[model samples]
Target chain A: MKNLWFHLMPYKDLPDDFREEHPSVWVDIDSGLLDAERVHQHYHEYLDELEFAGEVGFDGVCCNEHHQNGYGLMPSPNLIAATLTRRTSAPAICVMGNSLALYNPPTRVAEEFAMLDCMSGGRLIAGFPVGTPMDTIFAYGQNPSKLRDRYYEAHDIVMRAWQEPETFAFNGRYNQLRYVNVWPRPVQKPHPPVWIPGGGSVETWRWCAEMDYVYSYLSYFGYKAGAATMQGFWDEMDRLGKDRNPYRAGFLQFVAVGETEKEALELYREPAEYFYGRCLHVNPKWASPAGYQSEATIRAKVQSQVALAAAQSRAGNGQNGGGRPGPMGAARDWEQILDLGYVIAGDPDQVAERIRQVCIDLNVGHLMLLCQFGNMSTELAKYNTRLYAERVLPQIQDLFDDRWEDSWWPQPLEQPATARALA
Target chain B: MRETTISVGGHPVRVLTGGDNPSAPPAVFFAGIGGVPTWVPFLDRLAESRRVIVPSLPGFPGAADFRHLDTLLDWVVHCVETVEALDEAPVDLIGSSAGGALAAEVAAIAGSLVNRLVLIAPFGSHDTEDPGADIWAQVPGPDSIPNLVCERPEAWKHAWQVPEGAEAIDYQVMHTRAMEAAARYLFPFGDTGVVSRLHRVDHPTLLLRGSEDRVLPTSSNERFCAALAGPVRTGELEGAGHLPELDTPDDLAREINAFLADQELG
Candidate 1:
């Protein structure tokens, strides 16, 4: 129903042999590979593309946090979100959010999010993510065992800091604050609608359901691979006797549209290959650190499709022959990528049909479309965004809106003539 | 071998006790990163002369949770309390790898409870120049066992192998939990700032390391030797890895026993 534009802002110029030459795309990725001039140019171009998404017609624009990662350039997505707030008017600035555990005194996040909300005139969708093992545990050096504990405590502190009018003393296992009073309160009463971007953690689903927050599954693998995780989330909601309002869930998908299916596929092939092959060239060792995943989630993962594929790969090789390359590791041609539904590439009608089917199948209400991905030039990104905005978005925008109210969406105040004049 | 539970800090810790001589002061053995889930042969050899008490540090096999211990200081206090709760004051203390660092801390803080201290490849002091291999960075399961816990990973498979009747995934979870517990204290940099406090320990101490330890550098042993205020002796075992207890248990046990007896180690 709500088509939001998402950007990974990946470094587009990684050499063709990056996968072979580089140990990983994150954490310890060699600093020599990055070009300062190119990165500066890329940042300006990416920001322009995000603003263009707003001007052309996206309901929201999204950015997320990742540290020491080549694929995700934004270590501090708040800075990007802050810029977007001043530049874009109509679109919600969705910062799919800060890794809570990394902040020393997490009230820093509380203060920054409040500032963004005020800057955006209340058009802010606050995202709280229990960041990736690469970001939180490896890059930030958070104790994996205590990461979740620290995140939960930080969440409580941030929420209390935002909602509590009076100054308070907070004591937690991970953090102890003497006087907790956040300045410059957010324009949204009680706080902006909270969205939790998670990577198939079972505890995250249960927590989202219990807290009545939107569970946004930000999967790089497309909807076909993401269906199970989304389904798992809905099932948990069902078990908890919560309504399947659909607005409670969000799904991210890589989409590129053109005049014809063949045209779209040909247009996106280079970027798709670059994104999947090089951007996702993470070392298997860094994939899952100890205690980064909960035991229950690990159990679920063992029975998942990815695990089955790994088992088959191991069987094909000798018993002691090293681990199976992850889902993103194997070399995939364009057809395999399309067949596996890693990206939805087609004409407007075809793209709309596939997206609608995916939303209905997964019961997803917020469709976070990653129109700009790895190595896509500014011209190509705008072309993809404009084409989708002109044709595909209209067909899918009203699918769930009439049936359900999106409580998770931000309710921004109507802009005054004076504010527009100042801009 | 006898199995019992001792309540330390109100949490029941699983302890393994064995040896021929009960009249002598008990020898408390704190396990390394590869926790003692079952009876290890190295403990058996050490138990031959004196009573050996091996407590499954929290989040390891018998002790199932380390969440209650908030900080490294809390872990140290818990270790000291476990040692004190044994009703054997001034006992000979031996720790291996991660446990070695912990044992050194206990000896530094509670000198009265530890008569003699033995640290096998201890991890309390860190030298930035010779910072060892990143153990936490290694992939979990069979692939990393050689780099982390043992020299002969094939032979020491039992250290992390899935038990009969237990699901493979559960074994993975257990192994990960143990590693997580270890990471809680020694993450990022394996230093706990114990090097500065080592001057407090006045007891006779012995430091041992495996010649082939890939997880810790030889500089760590030197760091401990330089910082320790007590009478210190250092030895290295040939053909042993980070966890010499599982690599060359006979040689490791002989070294520990000799150290506790105040005799020259062969």
Candidate 2:
């Protein structure tokens, strides 16, 4: 299994009544509640934890872009990935990734991603995401109706800019550029490995399957809530007659680890409550901006609804138990979070056992672990990262070793002539 | 009244036509985001003197679902093609709310097609500062409590035919379709740069408003009156709201006749 560490970088301190007072943590969030010094501290701690993940031998370190959001501080995840290029020799410097629709020229993505590739010695996994409505349509004022169309065009432009040697004119309906040329083409020949992070959108699953890119179910909701979404993706792969290679998918989940379940609960309660209560307290109004979701996606939500209904039924039964209050939709106590599987918090052995079962059941190979979440201290995050790497990672590291080949992983790096000669 | 589908650029656009006499100039009615059905009564009243044509702009229910009309330009082109189909030399154009903005732009784009223009709380222009009360925010969603489209809820309750007790998918689909149509012309607040080219409008225009309407503020409607190039007339219905034609058809008909009669120099 490919273990990756993910970071959300939420502001450490939010008010007790943040849920009641602030209808949303995105779009039109009150700036009065934010302290510059606190965010400055958050950045330092988040970077430290990511670097520690690399040091502790995670297969990849991931970051993603979010705009006008208090929950996620990294609007330019590429900037963070660039910083990680120097800090660690990790296998993949995953900038999971740039919101292509938001960029004006889009060739800018090609240029920066290529730069990161060269700097990391060919260790770059490019993530293409159709941003959330709050980030794309509301905050940026992108015409919701035309956002996906623009996204596809931008993706085409960026890909061509990276691989195509000759300059060409891009006459997209939204973007019209006279000439497109990008310096420092990526080191991975054609381009870096592409991973598409989806949020239960049918179009995304189909697009990912057709493109042969990895479909990542990156929901704040725990694996238990997201199993249906993952199953739908696997089902699509089956319908398309594609191989059910476990590497074809990735899943992100919140997790905490300690010597025992009691200690884990004590360590993670505040952060878990903060995340459920504050980070996910987005206003429903900002969530859907007219045409932000395609008509087909809106219709396909019925299928998701069925899947969700099944999950809820399972939750009601003792079969799929986790947080009592659920991971997403509202704030919950640590016990509720634990009951709902929003976080696999326990001793190293317990975490490994739960994580192993989650992986086997969902048929996922790339496990993106959220070790640093909602106000987790840098020191505690480092400790958890180390524990997961040393104890939990060994228990199930060999489960998918012989199952399927990961076409999505970044290719191994080439050593310099001097280093080879010395060896 | 006869409802039929007309072919424009190989796409079938549904239109409702009533009281036709080829010799007399037709009154082309541009229906709002709700489509052309509710305007049946108002169109019947307008049809008393002369012919009337009401075409559903693409993307709304009862109209072509395909996204052939991709941009606002495509919509203007469709309206132009629609006018050409009528072969009417000088037709009076009347638009309501979202449709009002469409009619105003149609007149601006194809000036010769329109002889005189009347707008009922049209959505195209806005003041950057206050930017009128947001209509999208006010529109009822699948989960939201049904809000009145006009000031007097009972007067036009039937006019805003909001879906009820639909399955999750159907509810979402209905809400999404309406929101999508609104986003096409009025996404960031109905301003489509009509303010800059209002001088291009060769026809006299009437900017009508409902005084008590909160959606499109009266202050912003005043800007619309000032932006026009030709002789402009303005009026407000005291008790009515945004959907004035639906709420007070008699008063709206009186205002329409008086304006058209004066413009005809009769």
Candidate 3:
């Protein structure tokens, strides 16, 4: 099992009545609410927590791209990943990653990712996300109809830029590059391992399986809410006649570990509420742009749990009348958040047990554990990371390693000269 | 009304033709975002005198995928080809909302194919100070119907009603497809550089706006008028919204006919 530490690096100081006052946490988020000095402090604090997770024992540290939003502050996640390469040694620098469609000439992503890979001595997981509708279609002004087309074209360009030994002229519908060649080729032969972080788009599952890439479902809602999506992925794999090599999939879960279940709840309740309440207060308007979802996805979603919950809400029965809370809807209380599996908080043993069950149930080998969430202080983040590293990780890390080889993981130089010189 | 499938730029386009007089130059009607699934009462009124031909712009309901017309240039070329395929050179072109923008573009680039142009609540020019409501931002459903597209939501609801025996989900998908196609040109803001190209449009033009239009700003009317290098006539329809044809179809049809016949405004 591969346990990676992920950080959303959310703006920790949103007002108490942020959800009430603000219409959305993204796209048109009130610029006045953001404090530059605090954001500066947050960068250092969040970077420290990520590095601490690496120092403790996480196999990788992950970050991702979001734009014009308060939810995830890193618009340029590669910049964050670049810093991680210099500061952290043991962990894989996972830029869970650049939104390929947003780059004018997507070769820029290939160039920067290559730089990060070389800097980290090939410890880089190249994440190619189609990006959120809010990020891609709304914030960046990408045409929803053309976003996926541009993304696929960008992906091809990036891959060819890295692997095609000779400089080539590329002509695609969205992009036309006269000369396609990345200056600093990644240290990893044939490029670094590709992981696609998706929001359970049915097409993504088929694409991931066909490409032999890791399909990482980065759900804000934990394993319980994520079960259906992961199951759909494995089912897709089965349909494609591919083997269920657990390493082929990844799942992200928010975990808060402590000495006891009571202590854990007490320690995490505030941050958990903050994350679920304020951070996820996205306006329903910006949630799903037209053309963002393919016809297949839209058809599939008509019967999806979230859509069913939405229908119930529209029928005036209320969303939380029964069953789990919908992923997009706010879960304000700690009890509802826990009940919905938005966050998994308990004693180390209990947390590990739940994680083990999750892995076995979902068949996920790469576990991206979000130890630090909304408004979690740096000290608390470190404590949670260290506690999980000390107890929970040990019990859960060996679950799938014995049976499956993680082909999707990065292959860094065994003993780097830089490391030897530092030692 | 007679319906026929015509190949325009190698894409099958569903065209609706109707009128009493076929000898008069055809008044080619281009529809707004919510396409002409069937002939609305407004088109019926326009067909009373001269021939009316309405072709579903690609990616809208009754049309092929919008992907075929990727850029604004592609759309303009497709429109030109569509007009040419009708075998009516120098036709009277009438467009509503999004289609209005397309009509203006078509008239600008291919003036020889257009005798006169009518743009009703067009979306080509954008005013920063009074930029129209962001149509793409509105959530697709009943709640957003009024704010984004119409003044009278209840009346306009029938415009997008799910056809008899059609599944509601399928209707929703169709609606999404149409909106996606419109957003290709109008996303973020509705400005598509047609304002600059309006200079090439030397044909007689008529611009109409809904007095209560919530989508296109009032300032946009002036922008469209100022940029057109032609004799321009402008009118406002009361008790109407962005889609005047749906709001006050009779009034809209009268205005269109008067402008097309070169009658003085009352």
Candidate 4:
């Protein structure tokens, strides 16, 4: 379907003027209102937004986990997924999930995600991301060098728990549990579709293609910046003799829709600025040396229009004489981010056409849109949501509807008895 | 000293005391359900400085739960009376695990009496979902060995095993037998909400967590810090687990001393 998956980050109580001054990437709203009452308010509003996204004819909705940070107040995305199950009747509840290695037994994820699938009537799209260095190494206390290996181990454990029929013993480098029996088997036969969200790592692209999982580029960078990575992914797919089956590929873009391009740009400019400035702020220490990518791949991302790093640095230096440090300049520059096309603000028809072009260019099956970002107001987001669903969504509705009918992972899961009977 | 082995509402409780100078502040150490007088070494470090008392809890350690007391609330009331019976001018309380739940209840019930409090991985508040099955049992394989070791290897071995003198009532051994019988009484999930009553506790509080502790984890300590009514300070001793005093006595003693010194200064 050409329809976009729209997500709303309901942070309405943020300072009204935050988006005005901060870059769309970095609206550092003060956390003074982070008491229990405000937290509760955000929780309900966030749940409402998830339900609204599903109602708007989005193919799927997304939620992710972040901790001790105001950028995304979703410390527990699974809780949101649970709420989504009861609220929205359709749409996949995506939990760009529990960083595998951070959890003691990766089966905690296996069990919870399976439970989410059952609750959603098999509408779960499990996302296994080898989380960012900051999240993996600093926040979760995982060693940086061994991050991929731990993630692989976690992936294996969760997959085995879903697919293995019997109670088995899994002894891995990280997890060593004696009995492995996850209850409430997933509704999806073998498992729900697996989506690997990558930030342009060659290793990830090749692995996703090899495993036949949908490779979703979480493009916070813009379309032009993401071109190389997208091309690299398609190249990997080609090497595997894979067909351009849209379901195998997905791309996300930050989109804000309004009556006209000028209005859209005006409405989204500050929020977009905040997104580029405060929210994209990364500690230089955490940016880490570029790992697991060819020099050619790195250079390609640098040359792209989406080179956010340069724009960020220029903004960081107070390009508008704001002198406020744009948050993204703490690390790499415009060259690294230029190709990572993250921001896409325009009117409904313009966005719809642009998205269609993006799909055609990248040969991507899914288009994930972030209409609400960097403290964008709920009213503006809802407008974008309505416009996308009413105008843009219909334009590409039939683009891939009949192209792929079979699921990549459709094997039935083994329904094994839990070790402990509920007393 | 009004020393007594009292039978109250069916449970037989033994209380011992020291320091009765009316001007001296009162301190109570609620011992773990390990049955042995393991708190003696730790208490000796505090007794000379404050009016101190330690009570042996009923059940599992072979003492009878006189009224067949099966809940955390019942145990808590029994503890409050035990302190009141001494007639000391209120008491600052310290409790470990199940005892911590009792201490929290005492602070809730007799808020005026509690001057300062310390609770170490108390087991009694049953708010969180019952960790019904032992997580260790659910573990898939033998991979979590690093979680057990602290900086000192001998300390871990010592902490797990019961000492020769009172080997039968070792904390780990008592945990096995008493856990099944005590879990229902231990995980009184309903009791968790009352910790908010800590707001009534008008005294400074200190929370201690072991950095490498996998059993209770650091999240619990964070929750404890959030709930307590008064100002709270939390310290994590690296390379220590559930029994920090047993594993890293120096670090635990240093924290206790520092907290006490700060309290005295305040």
Which segments of candidate 2 are over 4 A away from where they belong?
A: A303-328, A416-423, B20-25, B37-40, B136-140, B143-148, B152-175, B246-250, B262-266
True contacts kept of 1: 0.73
**In lDDT terms, which candidate is top?**
3
Tens digits of per-residue lDDT for model 2, A341-420: 78889999999999999999999999999998887788889988999999999998887888677888887467612223
Q: Write the per-residue lDDT of candidate 1 for residues B235-263, one digit (tens) a residue.
A: 99999999999999999999888778765
- CAPRI-wise, candidate 1 is medium
Docking class of 3: medium
iRMS per model, in Å, is: 1.5, 2.8, 1.3, 22.0
lDDT of every model, 2 decimals:
0.86, 0.78, 0.87, 0.62
Q: Candidate 2, DockQ to 2 decimals?
A: 0.46
Candidate scoring better on DockQ of 1 and 4: 1
The digit string of per-residue lDDT tens for model 1 on A1-423 reads: 788999889998899999888888989999999999999999999999999999999999999999999999999999999888878888999999988999989999999999999988898999999998889888998988899999999999999999998999998888989999999888898899999998777788889988989999887778777876787888888899989998999888999888998899889999988988888888767777777887787777767645667766867853311222353454456777787687999999999999999999999999899999889889999999999999988888889877898888898888612245336
Predicted candidate 4 versus true structure: per-residue lDDT over A1-423, tens digit per residue: 534454534343445454355323212234563576866876776566667778888867888765545567766778888877777775777776577777778898999999988877777888888776556654554544345667899999999999999999988766789999999778897788898887766677778878889888875665765676788788878888987787787777777778887887678766665555555544443433222223344454435423445666766752321111224442123223222335555677887788888878877777777877766665666787888788888887777667675354223324422213211
Model 4 spans with C-alpha error above 4 angstroms: A2-36, A289-341, A406-423, B1-266
Report backbone clashes per prediction: 0, 8, 0, 61
DockQ for all models: 0.72, 0.46, 0.75, 0.01
* Model 3, residue pairs in steric clash: none
Ranking by TM-score: 3, 1, 2, 4
Q: Is candidate 1 or candidate 3 better by lDDT?
A: 3
